[model samples]
Target chain A: MAKEKKVHDRVNWHKEFRLAPGYIILSLWVLFTFVLLGWVVGASFSTSKEIFSGAVFKFETGIHLENYAKAWNTSNVSVFFMNSLVYASISCVLLIVICAPAAYVLSRFTFLGNKLIQNGFVAAMGVPATMIVLPLFGLVAGWNILNVSLANRAVLIFLYVGINVPYTTIFLLTFFSNLSRSFEEAAAIDGCPPMKTFWKIMLPMAQPGIITVTIFNFINVWNEYFMSLIFANSDKVKSVAIGLYGMINSMRYTGDYAGMFAAVVIVFLPTFILYVFLSEKIIAGVTGGGVKG
Target chain B: MFDGAALLHLIGIGKGVTRLKKNKTMIVVFVTPAVVMFSIIFLYPIIRTVLMSFFKIEGVTDAMSKWEFSGLANYIKLFSTELFRISMWNIFRIWFFGGIIVMGLALLFAAILTSGIRFKNAFRAIIYMPNVVSAVALATMWLQYVFSPKFGLFKSIGKALHWEWLEKFQWLDPSHLFIALLVAYCFGMVGYHMLIFASGIERIGTEYYEAATLDGANRIQQFRYITLPLLKGVTKTNITMWSISSAGFFLWSQLFSMVVSNTQTITPVVYMYQNIFGAGNSMTERNAGIGAAVGVLLSICVVLIFIVCDKIFKDNDIEF
Candidate 1:
């Protein structure tokens, strides 16, 4: 027994040693992340000369508030920011409105094509945007709708709603299923109609799930780049992602690195704030569907 | 002519049929919008893309009447193109090599955070911070601030460590560009996967660890015996998610490259983008059909990986 204990102790020591490197790596990564973000924040307030001089943190010549203004106004980040806000908010709302009823029905009622719709959503979730985007581009462009500003935004929103339905529905399906049936039964016993039960009782009952998925959808739409890049490339309706990308591209000639970083910070600020305030929701929304399954 | 009992049964059956019809209408009312949107946007586009790959489409704006049936020529052309071959190789490397690194590190960090670590939430938040930022922003920061030769983080660290080779390294150079992009991408991805792993680890009850400890099992032994087996489902999910994300990799590549068709950073999606939009300088003519072919190929790769993962990591009878 004593010998066995000694062997176990030795095994324990080996395990500790193995984990020591992990702790070190984690610490280094944490340090690297902070330093990099801190540097970016610092650089945003400094002049290009100061940034190039590598004294970004010093702030010797005072902070450049003008960089933010310049990035917002001259660089057209404000336009992009507004576009992103509009797209993200409207799409998120529309996503919930459209997907909630479908998810609720799929979860609650067993009807014809119920299993088929569920399976389709699961399969659709696996299909990447690249698989459909090329043909979608062709379909949209073939309509000659790209040149019209309103049509451009409408098409983009339509694509967003279409693409996100699968995910939002799947995410909500679990939530709706987990909800107890008693409330709906009670409402039905009280002579509440099925539609009314869903609208008034169940929708509000699934508020937490709805809010979580909405937050996720909002973040996704806000950060979306590729589709927006393909469809809404015009200056009138470009998203923050493309706007910052265009700014970065032109900065090569403009040489306004400080203002460019300012644009980066501005574009990053909304989602960063969202993450800071509702991080728990964000994390839950991201991992809930995958982990639960 | 019927008996009284048979007439009563017929009346009951009619009522049941009407109820089912009512239920059907309700279901249709609830499900129609999602179904219609999905069919139009997702199903139609996917089938059209698969069909489009078999045709010769000159431009995205070209009508169906203009599409010439090219059969397997698009696929044949894609396989023959050197750039397409390079892009496939790059995506494969990203999927496999990056998969190992990201999953390994994420699982490790997740384990550490869940193992009675101090400030677990704070650490998890910090790790996940990069994911919240836009990819374009993150990539730009990496290019200008982290990988830049003049005042990059690497340069400062190299100077401090007195590492001459590191100081002289050109991260954006053609030879080093892929590695640079992969590293930056892995950095952003680690946090997202870490959260997934952390959630998985958190789902396991603490009683198991207590029971293992009482049996004199060491931490590593407990992790191996208790954690790994239980996390089979989560690992499968992570692998699938990683493959899907890696397959859609485009923004980072385009951001990292100086030009649209930088061979070093060209990915399958970027190649598809080039073919569809005719944005890159390398393409003589826009072939939307080839782009669709690349899309079809990438989707196949993802589906195959998902299948293989499912087969390998069969969720056996591990009760929660």
Candidate 2:
């Protein structure tokens, strides 16, 4: 009876020790992220008075909808939001379309100078985008584009595509190479042309890749600042990222915390919502990009 | 129900009706938009920048009119300038120490979590959460969270600990500014690199560890023997990218540099901006030559750094 009781107590102890030190670290990471996000959302809702007063959980009186309205008008958030959407959408579409064929050719073809082209792109990736930004500014000024007044949205799109090409090509090359070649071959054997085979067979096979590159490019373009500041000086072309800088810089002394937080929420909400719902797709994209090849 | 013979006949007919056209024109048509955009948007600007860097401009305003062909002068000036020296040193400091610290912490976090810990996915998603938020939003949040002398959490904690540094020094001031910025940069980037490392760790086979455990090896021994060696390729990739990114880390510094107006802690890009778009900072106005000269210098530094890193790592076949 004594031996059996000792064994039972040991089993209980082992059960209690299931969560290891690794689990503690993981828990802390999760807690930190949640707390940071909670702080952002809480600060958004809380009035300046409540924020300073230490009434952390009084959601009823602290909540304010007017702050968003004030920011929307005063910060020109609506205009910037629309501009960002336009720029991001156009840039993403252009990036994928431009990069997809380049990636395909690089991955599939064994033409002369293929190594040279690949090296060029890899070298470009190593070069800082900021390094080139100054020269481009001069070029833009010299060309007298947009009548030398403001940087054009179209030009920004052009710049965005350039910055994105290297990354996109590499990303898609991995996806294309990993995908099976039999379907395209079979399609060609069945009297479909090479182009038709690529579109009907190979393109469909690369859907996950297409989605991943598009999402990443979209986010990158959306969050871009330095390039936007250089190439998008006008009100109509200012993306939300650039606009946020303008607002914060202007209001730094005025202490418009609520308004600024409102702008932050507006900027953060769409992507956050998408990530929350389509997390599986995002995870699949990231892992597939990294691991499959 | 229809007869089996009729169904078979109809399936063959359906296949015949949807036969594809064998046209080579379609390939060109499909490929044209992409090629044009790539050539114009990407290829053109790069070529233009490289070519323009070689030329000399005489007048500030008339960039087109006052250009002379001057070879390598811009590059020569780049090497001579004190500003360039400081910027290069700053870039090295950030890349060497800051990159190592951030990437190291990320790798450690990734390794610990890869033991099939509970809430693994939740932890990963949370860590990556920062990447979703705009950098502007992040900087704003961090500015308040760490820098506000009165209510900033760092200040309060320092005070509670009776730290002289808190009382005597300003974190965002020139003396300690880079340290503060380095901390913020690490916080912002750790999640990204962590995800990369975690995904890499997941790719490592569990059987290696299982065999090690059976052979009288402890957890530490198993990791040291198996995990570190396997993680070499990923480590290289992370290091290369972070190094390149650090070398280019001027944009945000430029934006927030104005926080301390009239200070020259501004990166190369900001310095260029101040020169070109002074906006009444001085009646002695913009110069394209200075801007192009800076660009040429920056590019040289980037290429040199890449070559040096490749030499140091000496492993070109990094899979990740």
Candidate 3:
């Protein structure tokens, strides 16, 4: 009986030893990640004097809420926010409308050069935006495509659609392929035409995939700085991501670290909130979508 | 396009409905938007970019007087340029070395999170927080507090530790620019990629690890035998993204660091940008030909990488 008890104790000790290192490493990683973010938040709140003086951080007598106001007006972020919404939202809508049908056709049909076309799209999806951004810039500028009023915005929408089409289409194609076609056939049997069936039946059923694609596309368009910086040179069309650059760069001369942080928080707030609320859905959609695709 | 054998080949064969007669109108309607967008945005511009490479701007004024065909001159110039070569290396370093760092860290984090840790939600949220933050904002935040040389947190920490090398080195220097970009890029990446990996690790059943553990396998041994093999699909996903993404590194690198004068960090795109829309230093007429050439080269590189990745990964039928 004593020997059996001793063996049981040994097993317990062994389990504890095995689990200890993983727990320690994980705890340290989690702590460091939080601290880094906390440090950013802390620096934003700290006064310039507090930042430069090298003394222990002390809270200001009054919170620097004015910094946010300054960032809003000074950096022209209000315009940026509006423009970003218009650009990202419009692009997301366009990608779904266009890519959904494209994906559906690709999923359902087998035609001449279909595999090649699909492979082409997959290969294109992997193409980096950097590879083509400049050439696209040249093509647009040389043709003077943005010379017309609101043409730049249209061009941007087009570019966004093209950039996102490959990935989202591939993603959605996978989803559509897995979907049972019985519903579509039943709709057809009920006298619904193919286009109508696609619009009403397949699309509604594909809501989860659509939402996932929209979220990815929205984030990509919203936070994209490179293409926006090149194309949307006017303040009227700047995105929050690009607009934030002006505030931070201004710090080189103005040295207002507090305001820069305020700008970061403001720019970060919307997407951050969205993530906090919908992260589970987004993560599930992506993981699930990836597997099916 | 029809074959009885191929139809039977795919899973759920009998469930698939008979194909309707090829409706040209339906095909056109369904395919137009995708086709139009692809042609204008991708194919045309690619061809245009290639054509741009063969011509040189000939003018005393800012406006182009004529396009003088300078066959392969720009390509010759690009090859001869030290900065272009270095920038190519920088691209390779980021995508290659950076790929290993990112994938490794992602796997480690995914493993820990799925290993029955406490506070999974909070830990996942905090780690993935960087994904929600704009790259521009994240870069500014890092520069302001983290990488700031004078009185920056990292600088101060280095000073306190008497790390003399850091005290003397400014990280923004040209030689260190790649490193700086890597650090900035890695933070933004941790969230999304790790989320994908974590979900993947979760999807993998615990039975494999339990079975291994019962066989006297240590934690590391179990991870090696069970986790790594199961995570092959996730790892391949990472590879697909990383390899092709190198073709687009110019966008991130340019935004992260302001280009240094007298030296060009000329990725093909940056070079094209300089040619098409002149920046502060290089205000010249639009060189559409050269831009086209660079675009074609970039398009070719993109295709090449896809082929190379496929060859390397082979046919791992593991999805996701």
Candidate 4:
């Protein structure tokens, strides 16, 4: 009845009993998280009065779909949503474009300052944003370009891409190093140049890593608050996070709780949906991409 | 700048004719853009921030020539400012108190998840879900709903349990605000550290546990002797990461106490922001140098923590 090598399949009551406390602890924590997120989702569809009374589930007057509409139009969440979408999409593509080639070259070839550059990047990851933001803000304010909407949008995306470049490049560098050099060897024998070899052969083989990194980058840029708060000053340039923060503050005076909750839902939905689908890859990549590998 | 860089590239390419030259060209063309971006975004600003800390600049945009050289005055003024001192203490409290809660829960959950549990992926994903969402929204939910006085989760629970005193406590009140912030923040952070610990646990070979079990060693003993010792490296990582994130603590504190900076939640970054960037809450005359000095001091704290961690966790030669 027992396959000694396959310990996962066999279940012992004693072991299960011993693990009862752990199961209780994990399930309770997970349940609380669900209740927290679930109650918000419920409140978003309820009237402000119903939410305050804690009858969000009664559906006394049916679901109020107009909360999303009011939030989207009246609260100007649509603009912030679109701005975030554009910034995240553009930043993701630019990160891949800039990081892929550099990762490939750094991993494939050993040259001067390679180790120094790698060490510098690892160090930069630990550098507090405060350390760098002051001067960057100064330099850009000196340029006096933030007042213009188009320039401000471009600057925001550029900064997003710039801050993320080191992480993305180093992540892809590990992925590139894992790939065999035999493909490049075979390509070189066929009169293919190094750059051509990278684009045609190695790049396609690194699709999984690139997709993981792009998803990671997408979530990061979407959820980014501090940089966008500091850089994107105007409503036209504001991201969803800043937009939601503004709405919550104003809602206090306006007393539109339902609409404010809808805005919160809209702000967090994109990354939550992404996480729902790719939790496996995202969780696995969390440690590898987050700290020093 | 682009024209200058393009001209340099042109001049550099004009001299390459051999195989080595072609390979060099490829490497140069590929890595130059990233290095350039990093230099502008991180390198130049870091250098400037450090240098700016030593001089008294009237405005954020003051030219270098206008920066009056005032050695250590900024630091003196910053430490002397009562608000800055309070902000430093607040951040330290967050790091100390919040670190204990996050690390404890993180380790507990990590151990449970890696204990041959079923549906491990589902549990892990659910726990880590908060980090996937916008932190601003998460804080908003806490401030508006979870801690709302009219009808909050805690209040409702307290009422249902018939605990009058618990229900009467105002979580958002100044007396309880810091604890409330720490609780909400720690809840979101545990998932990240748990994932790190889980990965560290997974890396330990199962054979060791098997060997211990054959010798009649129990789970707790095995954990105390083997798991704890082996997880020293990952524990260091957890602490370092927690410190780094704590150093950049602005979003939550700002969200908690906006418009006017509250003493309970004001972190050094928030203080720096209000001082230099002028979030329009000026408690004192703006000294841009003090803001820069705060940045420098925070960075020094991070570096010091890193060095201390390295010393605490020696490079043991015990081969895995």
Q: How does chain A of every candidate compare to the true chain A by TM-score? A: 0.91, 0.87, 0.87, 0.95
- TM for every model, in the order presented, reads 0.92, 0.84, 0.85, 0.94
Clash pairs, candidate 1, are none
lDDT of each: 0.86, 0.69, 0.70, 0.87
Model 4 C-alpha lDDT per residue in residues B228-320, reported as the tens digit of each score: 888878888888999999999999999888533368999999989888776555656776788889999999999999899889877532211
lDDT of 1 at A250: 93
Error of 4 at A157 (Å): 0.5
Docking band of candidate 3: acceptable
Q: Write the per-residue lDDT of candidate 3 for residues B1-320, one digit (tens) a residue.
A: 78543434453244344444534556668877887777777666555455556777532122334667799987787677665566666666777778778877777777777776667777777777777667777776666666666666567667878998876667666776667768767766766677777876777777877888789998778878876777666666766666655666655565555634323234555665565555526643455555555556666765676567667656454557
**Model no. 3, DockQ:** 0.44
Ranking by TM-score: 4, 1, 3, 2
> By TM-score, how accurate is candidate 1?
0.92
lDDT of 1 by residue, B1-320 (tens): 85655554455444444545667777888889999999988898899899889999877768789999999999999999999999999988888889999999899999998875556777888899998878888888899999988899998999999998988899888889888989999999999888877877888889999999999999899999999998887888888889889889989888888633368888999888877674467787777889889889999998888789779888744311
Model 2: CAPRI class: acceptable
Minimum summed lDDT over a 10-residue window in model 1 chain A is located at A284-293
DockQ of candidate 1 (2 decimals): 0.42
lDDT score, residue B76, model 2? 74
Runs with alpha carbons beyond 4 Å of true place in candidate 2: A1-19, A53-60, A113-115, A142-151, A283-293, B1-36, B58-65, B69-72, B75-80, B155-170, B262-265, B278-287, B314-318
Listed per candidate, the RMSD to the true structure in angstroms reads: 6.6, 6.1, 5.1, 6.4
Q: Tens-digit lDDT track for model 1 on A224-287? A: 9889999995899999999888899899998999999999999888889888998888787777
Q: In angstroms, give how far residue A127 of model 1 lies from its true place.
A: 1.2
Q: Identify the leading candidate in terms of lDDT.
A: 4
Models ranked on lDDT: 4, 1, 3, 2
